[model samples]
Target: MERLSLTLALGDYEHTRDLATGQVPVQGVSLNVLTLAPEEAFFRFTFFREWEVSEMSMGKYVSLRSQEDKGITAIPVFPSRVFRQSMIYVREGGKIDRPEQLKGKRIGIPEWAQTAVIYSRGYLTHQAKVPLGSVEWVQAGVNQAGRVEKVKPKLPEGVRLRPEPQHSLNDMLLAGDIDAVLSARPPRGFGSGIRRLFPDYEAVEAAYFRETGIFPIMHVIVIKTDVLERHPWLAMSFYKAFEEAKRRSVERLSDITASHAPLAWLAPYTERMKNLFGEDFWPYGLEKNRTTLQAFVDFAFEQGVCHRRLELEELFPKQVLTSFKV
Candidate 1:
């Protein structure tokens, strides 16, 4: 039988490189992979369904799923996971010296429903004791103007978010129009009178992970529901391929003979991560990531990114939920 032909659009990630380069095959599928930037792939795929399979923001996916949009379904293959403590930026010599000071301050975000902002806001509310309504939120692009939220979020009661399409968050934060900014990418003026809210963010993020067993997930692999309906086996094939690719990347990270990563002391860092998280630190699959996934659903709902709370099962298709054991 001829293999099913499919197209996938996603960011050029180190872990997914093998799959993208065709070193790893998706079981019986002939994948035409388009390695685009995450933003481009997300925008095109979310709005236009540009590809049969793509990487989608968890926040946006949860929002869409909550609204009962059945156009797309996901596998448990997460392409991106990041801790957002380091994503927050504050002005130097500003009143907001600490996370607690974020209360009653103005914060800029690229979008209200942005995955990074959702996780950052969740951290503020749960860890920093700052309520979502405590501060005003300004929305705009990170470095350019006229960016808007792709999804319409039902703002929770007492939440106040204003869109400023005329100016970028980078400019606003530099001009002090916004007290701080929560962004995945650092603003252009990051070092020019701007600094991370947590100067020692690595330690803070590690501690946060320890305190709450939630290593925040940013993006999930999704396929058009119609495509899945026609080819139900595609989900497991994609999941298994992604898992093998990630496993190879992890093995390369642990190699001490020669550095797979450019960073010095990568082996030690990988070991540290292994100690903090288990051997499969960057894990794929439902059970290993349930804590983070469940927390994200709760956060997205509470923050109004999702109109209503969503069960974990609702996010992924049943085919990829479990694999047959040998």
Candidate 2:
């Protein structure tokens, strides 16, 4: 039987490398994989649908899904998961030394709908007890000028967000124009005089996980709706292949005989993560990730990234949601 041919655009990550390199194969599908930077892949696929399958920003996906845009549907495969507590940046000698101090401050973000910013704002709102409306929001590129939001979000009442296309967030933060910056990528000024709001972020993130049980999701794998309609089983095939690839990456991370990653004490760190997050530290699928997914959708809605709240069940194809047990 001839296999279904598909193209997948994804970031270069250890977890998905096997699948991208063809070591792992999607059942009944021939994949032509393109490895690109996350920003490039997301922009191309989100705007033009350049590929049949792509890694998408969770905030952007939920925004589109909530608006009932049926251009694409996702499998439960998550290519990126990150904790955003460390993503917040504050200027040296800034007044905002604590989370509560964020009130009435100007915070710069790459986009209001950015996945990382959504999670960061969620933490501020729910965990830090800071009301979203209390702070003035500034939108701009992280390090460069003229960046614009990719999707239109329904801003919640009292939430003030304005775009500064002429200046980057990095420049604004350094110049004291914005009190702080929330972003996934560090600003260009991060090392010089800017520092994380939580300087000891690893402990803070671990504590947050213990309290909230959310290892915030950054990206999800999406397939064009038309392709899924023609081949309904494609979802499960893709899910299974991604699962296997992730499993291998986990195994490599846990291997103590030799280093699978360049970092020192990787094995010990992996073990620590397992102890904190359970054996399947980095998990895929709806049920396994329900807490994180549910929290994200709720945040997306409250932050105006999503037009309405999205249910966990509505996020992925049903095929990837369940499987036949042997």
Candidate 3:
């Protein structure tokens, strides 16, 4: 039987390297993988549909789905999961020393629907007791001018959102035009005097994980609806392949013969993560990630990034929802 050939746009990460290099094969399918940075991958795919399968932001996916855009659908394979406590950037000597000070302050963001920004806002509003309405919001690119939100937002009343296409968040924060910036990517010229709002975010993130059990999902694998229409099994095939690749990466990393990662204590850190998250630190699918998925859904809606709240199960194709146990 001839295999289905699909183009997949993804970031070049250690976890995805196996699949990208064809070291691990997808059953009955051929993946023409394009390794790209997260931002470039998203922009290229969003604007050009350059690939049939791509890594997409959970926030943008949810917001787009809420608007009934049928361009793409997702599998539960998340290529990137990160905590956003470290995403908030502030000037070296800024008044926004803590999350509480962000209230009633002007802050810049690349987009309203950025997954990292959504979680940063959620943690600030819900966990840190800062009201969304209290802060004035500015939207723009992190390092360049003229970036805009791909999805339209329906912001709640009293939540001010101003677009500053004339300047990037980096410039705005540096010029004192904005108090702080929320971004997934570090802004250009971000060093020396500029640093994270919480330089001690490592400890903060650890505490947050213990309290909330949310590791914060950043990106998911999306298949163009047209591709899936002809082959529904593509979803499961892709999911299983990704799962196997991830499992193998973790296994290799844990092996002591040669260091899979450059870290001096990679094995010990990997073991620590397992203890922290229970078995697999990075898990795919619905049941294992229900809490993180539900919280993200809630955050998207509350932040007005999504027009309506989404149910977790409805987010992915039904084929990847269940697994056959041997």
lDDT of each: 0.91, 0.92, 0.89
Q: Compared with the true structure, what per-residue lDDT tens digits does model 3 show for residues 59-119?
A: 8899989988878999999999999999889898766778888888898999999999999
Off by over 4 Å in 2: none
Per-candidate TM equals: 0.98, 0.98, 0.97
Using lDDT as the measure, what is the rank order of every candidate, best first? 2, 1, 3
Candidate closer to the true structure by lDDT (higher is better), 2 or 3: 2
The candidate that wins on lDDT is: 2
Local accuracy of candidate 2 as per-residue lDDT tens digits, 1-326 = 99999999999999998999999999999999999999999899989998899999998999999999989998888888888999999998777788989988899999999999999999999989989999999999999999999999899999999999999999999998999999899999888979999999988998999999999989999999999999999998999999999999999998999988889999999999899999998888889999999899989988889898788888888778777888
Q: Least lDDT summed over 10 consecutive residues: which range in candidate 1? A: 314-323
The 10-residue segment of model 3 with minimum total lDDT is 185-194
TM-score, structure 3 vs. true? 0.97
lDDT of 1 by residue, 1-326 (tens): 89988999989898999999999999989989998888888888888997799999988898999899989998998889999999999898787778989999999999999999999999999989999999999999999999989899999889999999899999999898999999998999888888998999999999999999999999999999999999898888999899889989888988999988789999889999899998889988899999999888899999988988888888888887887988
| Residue 161 Cα positional deviation in candidate 1, in Å, after optimal superposition | 0.8
Q: What is the lDDT of residue 21 in candidate 3?
A: 88
Per model, how many backbone clashes are there?
Answer: 0, 0, 0
